[model samples]
Target: MYQKIIKESNENKIFQYLFKSKENFVINDIANALNMSFPTVKRVVDILVKKNIIVERDKIGEGVGRKARVYGFNPDFCYSIGIRITSHSFQFILINGYCEIKKEKLYNIELDTSSIVDSLEECINNFIATLNVDEKKHLIGVGIATRGIVNNEKNFVEFSNTDSFPLRSLESIRKKLGVPVLIENESNLAVISESILGLGQKLNHFVCLTLSDSISCSTFQKEQHDSFSFKAGRIHHMNINPDGNLCECGSKGCLGSYISDKALILEFKKFFPEINDFDEIFSEKYLETNFGKLLINNYIKHLAIGIRNLLFFSNPEKLIITGKICKYKNIIKPELLKAIYTPNHIFYRGEDTILFSKFNEQTGILGAAIFPIVDSLF
Candidate 1:
């Protein structure tokens, strides 16, 4: 029993090291970095190669003691499906083990359009049917990203703002598909994706502030036994003022009343009243106007305050900002950072403790896909 435990521990360390690696390595490299003996690294590498999780990419060196084989993590060893659910649409992505999106599709949907649960199940099963032979063979599971609070214990959504979104536990779908099914908040999923595949890969703690069409935030804390937990997507509704503007949640002074999609649209329409592009909220034409100036100043102020609170409370190694707001990173991200910058503060002085996700649009589903991969392997 003792020997089996140690063997499994070694296998886990080696597999995770390879999965998180961006470059292929030789046996010496793995042994040195992981502080394992050369022989032990070779044994684990051979095991992973046999499982098809790692593959021989090339050989390195010559003329010395013979060429050394280079091993690469093979993402194509398995696959998963990620689904993002919204009141207006369902977004889907198929990803391999590496978490790179291989396929994407969007379907316009609404609660009033049909029985939300039935339609979604049918859609997912239909999507599965379209996979090729190898894809179906390697597919591991499905992950659903939703705004609702997921009750994984019961396999149903317990709370949702839409009130009519899919409330049925996806366990039935899991049975039909013959693979595991999981659900998580979209913001939590985004943070999970970052932990597994993005800047937070090596970090034990972090926070992700997600800005899709809506605003939400979640924190990541790696627990013992290789488990992960996230909480507080409702951070958007944290009241910043007691007497400020009304939020859609029927509360005044909520942070969402100031910076959420509806707030931005309501504020922008007061001036432009014309059709608006989300990017234009930061456009030169918009910001130069008096109303835009006030709007931006307020946005920067509250954004900084919210971020500062998150930093101090969570004390994460890094803070990841994900959303369409990043498209204006050139203007918004810098200014927000500057607002929070303090002369004596170490984190803000130059280190990239705060970071932006590369592609805001993709992380939700990508994160959704990675949840199951983490569940199965790690």
Candidate 2:
């Protein structure tokens, strides 16, 4: 059993190295890079080749010794389903071994948050049923990225930004779907997605701040991440103001209460009773008014406060801002950075200190999709 574990570990390292570099490597080079024995590397390479996860693509160092066979990752060996559950939709993506999206579906039906477990199962099973027979056979697992404190080991969510409270066991969904299932906080998943697929690539330390229905923060360091830590990365309730508005978490002056979409909408409804929905705040007719100016200004002010606190604590290599609010990044950038800026850090170089994703709407699902691929490897 110990030997098997070591072999699997070596296989994982070699595979990840090849996959990340997107380069062809021979057994000797892989062994040398990974500090594994040549025999072990050869064994793992053979297994991966047999499993159709990698292939001999070319020859290298033709004159140095004998021509060494080079191998590269095979993207289509298997695929996984990734889902992000929002209040109104089940966002889905099918990603191949290479983490390239193959198919995407947005189930627009409203979720019955009171029965999220049943709704989730129905959405997943129904999505899987739409796949072709070949695709179904190649499906490896399902990954869920949710906006909440998720205990993946226990497969239950502690709390969600949506009305989902005390989520039921996901093991039931796994059994019914008849496939492996992994769940992660959408914030962490978004950071992971950025690390693997976006501007955060090759970065060991960074923070992802997502401003959606509520605010969320996820940090990545060189150290191992414990996805089930429960309390890890839960910064939405931090007290940034002592005399500010109240939050649903029963706290006054919570950071999330200042800039979350729901917060903005609630505040807007005070002046215009019929006003609801964060999207409506962007209408040109409304945004050109004095109320819009005040709201946007307040959002930038509080956003800076939250960001300053985050940077002071984590001091990450970069700060990635993603979510629906990012659509207005340009409008907010000037004021937002000014409030968070200092001579030494935060935004010393202005916009360079912050990175924004081009694919705002899909960040959560993309990260969720990559979770299954990461789970399969490690």
Candidate 3:
């Protein structure tokens, strides 16, 4: 059984090693690192090279012996499409094997099951028309990130608050697009991106809090005993205040009610009726106002309360905060740290446990693009 597991994991181990390192490696080095025989490593490398997943780069001589050929991943060998669907817009990005965006387009359209499928077909067709024949041949699959519970097994959305978006399977979109489709919750996608490519790369256990149009959290833990674990989005509904504002989930005092984009906008409009967009509320001119300062203070307090609850429950090695709220890192981080570091809450650790997202807005889409590649490897 142990041997079977190792045999099954060999390809994934090799791919992960090559993906993590920036430099090329000879077959011998790969064998040594992976603790596999030289012939076995060479066989795997040869297969990958033939598949265009990796390529032989250059030869380097050691002493007076023959030079050894080094192999490296082929970043442009294939591409994937990543789509982020929200109530107000859809963001489409094309990423190469190296997980870099080659092209991106954003469309502001009201979302429903039928409209999303139609728009996706049109956008994909137009986008593919722009690519050359060689680039077109490299197209592999598509991954979508959205703001709700996704039944990955059925490729359907279970429920969502995006106005009038239907609860339906994605088979229609899959047939129209003619590619493998993967759908995941936006917050889960963000955490996956962080775990593989962002601040959580070195952490085996961490919590990600995303403050976007809504607020959500994802906790990642390396399996211990394999007992069933709670899913990530459940943390979004954690109760923070008993008599606080009512939430769309039909609950009062939920954390999301205090920190979501809609909540912040409502708070801002109460002070400045002239404010038209959420982006304007974050402007330096607006933030300088007394009302803006009050809003900031309230936001920080609630955000801190939510983070404190997460720390106590999960005890994660790190807590990463992302999304639109992070744009005000300068104002948010200080007050957040101050609130969390109080003597009574010191047991949850200090500022060292916290980190702001590195990828910012692109985190979810990039995660979507890499999903296929990572899934194939593992």
Best by lDDT: 1
Query: How does residue 91 of candidate 1 score in lDDT?
Result: 84
- In model 2, pairs of residues that clash are none
Error of 2 at 116 (Å): 1.0
Which of the two candidates, 1 or 3, achieves a greater TM-score against the reference? 1
So what's the TM-score on candidate 3?
Answer: 0.87
**Which wins on TM-score, candidate 1 or candidate 2?**
1
lDDT of 1: 0.76
Worst 10 residues of 3 by lDDT: 1-10
lDDT tens string, model 1, 223-281? Answer: 66555677746776788899988877788887867776557767888878883767667
Q: Give the TM-score of candidate 1.
A: 0.87
Task: Look at candidate 1 and give me any clashing residue pairs.
Answer: 155-169
The local distance difference test score of each candidate is 0.76, 0.75, 0.75
Task: Give the number of the best model, judged by TM-score.
Answer: 1
Question: Can you write out model 2's per-residue Cα lDDT over 172-248, one digit (the tens) per residue?
Answer: 88787677887777887787678777878767678888877767888766444322211237677889888888988
Stretches of candidate 2 off by over 4 Å are 1-8, 23-44, 56-72, 152-155, 160-168, 224-231, 265-291, 342-352
Residue 25 alpha-carbon offset, candidate 1, angstroms: 2.2
Error of 1 at 267 (Å): 1.5
